[model samples]
Target: MPKSLTTSEPNVLRPEDFDPPLKRKEPIVPYYWTLDEIATELGVTSRRVGYDITGYPPRKIQPSLKAYKAGSLFLVPDADALAYIQRFRERKKS
Candidate 1:
């Protein structure tokens, strides 16, 4: 039997022996909002988020929202949400 397995040898797994997961060179910063969150923020429903993306002419739902699609999920950055709401007042005034 190997000395490492049979005996408590110094070569046994140590804290320094393991390699950590690879990290990105640059720091990562993510600020995102889900469709459900957007709905709640605007006092609406997730279904309304979809409608806002694609306006419903008959329902008088106009598409005026920005969203980022990562795969099947949609995300709205915090900055964008603020801008969207800020522009809302300007657009209404116009």
Candidate 2:
């Protein structure tokens, strides 16, 4: 048999002898909330949510509240939705 290149025994496998284990990489995807989801959380109908998104009569218009359209579905970022909800609640208190 040819001489072993490593200092360890011919057949022995040691954890320390090998390189460090590779870490699992998680996919980086942004969180989004659908209009129905926001409506469900606020105990309202999706129609009302759409009105809020469009700043119709009765509801105060908020330019900062943004919604993105993907085909027939509209999506809002999690952070923006939470912020908008908080602001809406605060406005109601006034």
Candidate 3:
């Protein structure tokens, strides 16, 4: 009869050692919207929207007027607009 010897290694696994997939509600991706659509959604003039969110030197798509290209649409960041609104509201409350 042969006897088996156990090495000095731990049998349990730690949570940090296990590689679990990251769980998220939505994938992180950039979203773009046209100025007209954004104005309509927020119920404001396009010029006012641009002024309130981005002052001079507005964030633009910079499309080539000479030739039409696929996926040529440009947009400002929605989160930045939302943040502007939040700050505006805070100022109004004060």
Candidate 4:
């Protein structure tokens, strides 16, 4: 048998050597949406998402849950954007 050429110690796995699993505080569902994402999800242009505020009812006619802005980049949380569209439909149907 040939002599071993490597000098590094073996990396044997042990139960006590492992790190604890990560704990998550937030929901698993995708959280935030940019203007482009909102448009893609709703099948419209990014400009439309920016203009319509996630398809919120017109601000003048109804209270609006407007899109958010972060670090000069506009964003809309996924939940809020979907809610805005739902409420828009609800309002229009009535």
Candidate 5:
């Protein structure tokens, strides 16, 4: 007959008895801003931003302002939005 090792309490579980928990690696998500958000940040109306994108009379088209359409929603990538803002500032300076 094999002898079993005894514990102080047979019902209790010890931390040393199980393997350590795995460290979860978080995924890196890209940042994006909606047209409304961009307009709010730039202190402009959403319609003005739309005109900058699509080019209305008097307002020349800005091809650098890249916008992605997902269904009815428009999304601008963080980097692209920053670039567009920089360009707009330069245009205002000139």
Candidate 6:
């Protein structure tokens, strides 16, 4: 038999030799939500949520008049809520 040409060590791997697992992505739900619930998800008070959307296109929902001001029992999309939640998390990390 011919002699082995390679001089490198064998490529055997032990259970402890493995690298740590990668971080998993945050889970996303496929549901719409009301402002109160969205505020909870973003870790903020509901008043702040109201302020965040002020002078912006309102969330799609039936409009009701609260005295002279308008209000919505409408649902905001999960993606929009997630974007706000992401900002909240980043702010907390600093």
- The pairs that clash in candidate 5 are none
**Model 6 lDDT per residue over 1-94, tens place:** 1234685554432223323311222323234455666566556787666656553346553322111122545455645554555555567779
- Per-residue lDDT of candidate 3, residues 1-94 (tens digit): 1133565553432213222311222322344334544455445686655554334454553421121112643354444433333444456569
- Note the Cα lDDT for every prediction shown: 0.58, 0.60, 0.40, 0.52, 0.57, 0.47
Clashing pairs in 4: none
Clashes of each: 0, 0, 0, 0, 0, 0
Q: Is candidate 1 or candidate 3 better by lDDT?
A: 1
Estimate the TM-score of every prediction: 0.49, 0.53, 0.33, 0.43, 0.54, 0.45
- TM-score for candidate 4, residues paired by index: 0.43
> What's the true lDDT of residue 46 in model 6?
74
Candidate 2 local lDDT, 8-59, one digit each (tens)? 6554332232223212122123577778776765666888778767777556
Q: Candidate 1: where is the Cα deviation over 4 Å?
A: 1-29, 85-94
The numbered model that scores best in TM-score is: 5
Clashing pairs in 1: none
What TM-score quantifies how close candidate 1 is to the native fold? Answer: 0.49
Q: What local lDDT score does residue 59 receive in model 4, on the 0 to 100 scale?
A: 54
On a 0 to 1 TM-score scale, where does candidate 3 land against the true structure?
0.33
Residue 86 displacement (Å), model 5: 2.1
Residue-by-residue lDDT tens digits, candidate 4, 1-94: 1235685564433223223311223333356656665555455577655766534455543334566677755766655755655544456569
What TM-score quantifies how close candidate 2 is to the native fold? Answer: 0.53
**Counting only residues 3 or more apart in sequence or on different chains, how many pairs clash (N, Cα, C under 3 Å) in candidate 1?**
0
Of 1 and 4, the candidate ranking higher by TM-score: 1
Clashing pairs in 3: none
Q: Write candidate 1's Cα lDDT for 1-94 as tens digits.
A: 1245666764332223223311222212356666766565455588877777667899999988778887777777656654554454345569
Q: Order the candidates by lDDT, highest first.
A: 2, 1, 5, 4, 6, 3
Candidate 4 Cα misplacement greater than 4 A, ranges: 1-30, 54-65, 87-94
Ranked by lDDT, the better of candidates 3 and 6 is 6
